[model samples]
Target: MNTRTLIASALALGFLAACSKPEPVVEAPRPVVVFTLASAQVAPAALYTGEVRARYESDLAFRIGGKIVERRVDVGAVVKPGQLLARLDPADAGLNAEAARAQLAAAENEFAYARAEVLRYRDLVAKNFVSRSVLDAKETAFRSATARVEQARAQASVAGRQAGYTSLLADQPGVITAVGAEVGQVVKDSAVVMKLARDGEREVLIAVPESRIGELKKAGRVEVRLWTQPDVALAGRVREIAPSADAATRTYAVRVSIVDPLPALQLGMTANVVLADAAASAGGLLVPITAVFEHGGASAVWVMQAEGELVKPVLRKVTVRQYREDGALISAGLTAGETIAAAGVNKIIAGQALRPVAPARPAAAPMAVRPGAAS
Candidate 1:
């Protein structure tokens, strides 16, 4: 092998290698579920079930304890002022009044006798037939008898008032909503015998859960609608909210005052209450839950950016306002109309080429096949 021959062989080998080129390396783009960012449609208000009630409902009870002898009113009965609703047994009250009157009469007779004796004693004292001490004793007896007469009169007045209480009279005009006592039933003093709902000013009562109590406090507008009259909506305001949650249901009781209630609204009617906030329902963007991934100890998503004819994944950090069952509410770091990888976000990397496929649809359920059907 001379120098010229070796150089000629190396040149021939290099020419052959240059003429036969190596196969080109082509990278296939990865398929990914894509999603577009857009403003989420939020509900204008939250709904709660409620019941219509009167603004003033009171329990009617007997002032004195006795067995009921008469019940003139029943549930749903309309009553007027001073109208008799019920009556207790008058035997006891009448007897007490009679006893008081008899005692008063006896006191008056004793007073008359004392007055006569005092006069006689005075005459005797003037004539020197009786001592001055005897006249003084007679005057004292007259004064004591007069005091007894006055005391008996007061007792008679109380007894008369008690007899009037035996008859239950309606203090106000209202409709009876409940009846707790009937004829022949014995009731104690102050025990509720009936329920009356005054015919004015209606309200809706609803229960709210503790989780959405903050939204209730910030409610901008409230609306109420009766179940029977769904088209007619009444303006309402939050009149009261329970300070604490209920022990059994663990919900707060809310009362809404209807501004101008219609005639159709009756007691115990079912209704619906809605709470709305215009400010809070705007400017939120939702993305698929799978699109969000943790990147560098922060929440991020793989945003798709067009690189000429190919789409590339770009890691972008975003501020997640809330994570919902359907998606994550993105408050920042993403603009409307932008596209992102909806699934397989963990496998995505910056500058990675992507195919940008539409989101995968949920799999259809298999059709039921009966025995001895098609093979």
Candidate 2:
């Protein structure tokens, strides 16, 4: 009686304890960061490598053709205005000048003789010793001789200037960036001997591809970051844009001037020209590029539905008119102010529950009130 009664009592106790135990509690919905889609004119930032350059650059050259006798300044030489950069062989220029001087001297002697003859003829005419036509011929001779002398004198002045042109001088204070001609090399008039970058406002030179040329033309907000000093970024504006694309690279040359000058930014420093996505100019709501994913050959975003205690993500197809490197603008399918999952969109699936958390920005559409938000 004891063994059977004890076994049955133990079984009954075990059954009652199991039945009294509460059912397994369901897990709370996963909390997720949900931001309301805002209509902000934002675009992805683009970056391009470039070089820091002077706003004003000029090519120094000889004004007259001659063999270079000496090149005083090399590349990277800082020069002041009127500084002699190079010298040319002045022998030919001097010879031409000398010949011009000799011609002027001979023309002057002829003019003096003609003047004497004109005076003698005038005296004879007044005394009625010569006919009027004869005196007129002498005056014509005098006028011709005087004109020849002036022509020869002008030639001599031009020849003197030609000799002076043999010496190449800097027209402005600048640093020499390039040397195109060397000593013993014969260069023609205006042949670039050196490249001068004037000391002034600094600029960044970048080549924008044809695809991005439109953005350059607008000259939207640009920032230049130096390679040596990545932390230092200078805001800049498009100072000049080439009218046509480069024949070799098929890229347009763009010059961006620094809004504020800094000592660190010098001529020919490697830099990065950052261009903002064309959204500010063209109004559109910006979304993270990663936020939008492609599925079934179509683009879509994950939208949340607010349940009493759970928020569920539902796949919504959106029309994307344009895209940026880091984000995209929703052309259609997403409504302003609706909460959308941005952080872990790939992990989410239809019917997956979540906890809706409001973002910093005000939501256009109210978010689902969390269970504890009622207070």
Count of clashing residue pairs in every prediction:
0, 4
* Sequence-dependent TM-score of model 2: 0.65
Q: What is the lDDT of residue 130 in candidate 2?
A: 95
Candidate 1 lDDT (Cα, 0 to 1): 0.81
Model 2 C-alpha RMSD to native: 14.5
- Please identify model 2 stretches exceeding 4 Å from their true place: 1-44, 210-220, 278-295, 298-375
lDDT of 1 at 141: 96
lDDT of 2 by residue, 1-375 (tens): 799999999999999998896889998777776766653322245667888888888987888898999988888898998999999999999999999999999999999999999999999999999999999999999999999999999999999999999888898998999999889998899888889999988988898877787777786568888888876768889988899889999888988888886776678789988776544233445566656888789998888888887788989998776765435766668766776787677778789779877555543322111112211
Cα lDDT of all candidates, in order? 0.81, 0.80
Candidate 1 per-residue C-alpha lDDT over 1-375 given as tens digits, one digit per residue, 9 for 90 to 100: 899999999999999999997999998888888877643333434468888887889999988889999999888898998999999998898889999999999999999999999999999999999899999999999999999999999999888888898998888888999999989999998999999998778888898888678877876558898889987888988888899999999999988899988877788999988675332244346677788988889999988998766689888999876664345766678877788888888888788878878755842111111223221
* Per-prediction TM-score to the true structure, in the order listed: 0.63, 0.65
Error of 2 at 235 (Å): 1.9
Clash pairs, candidate 1, are none
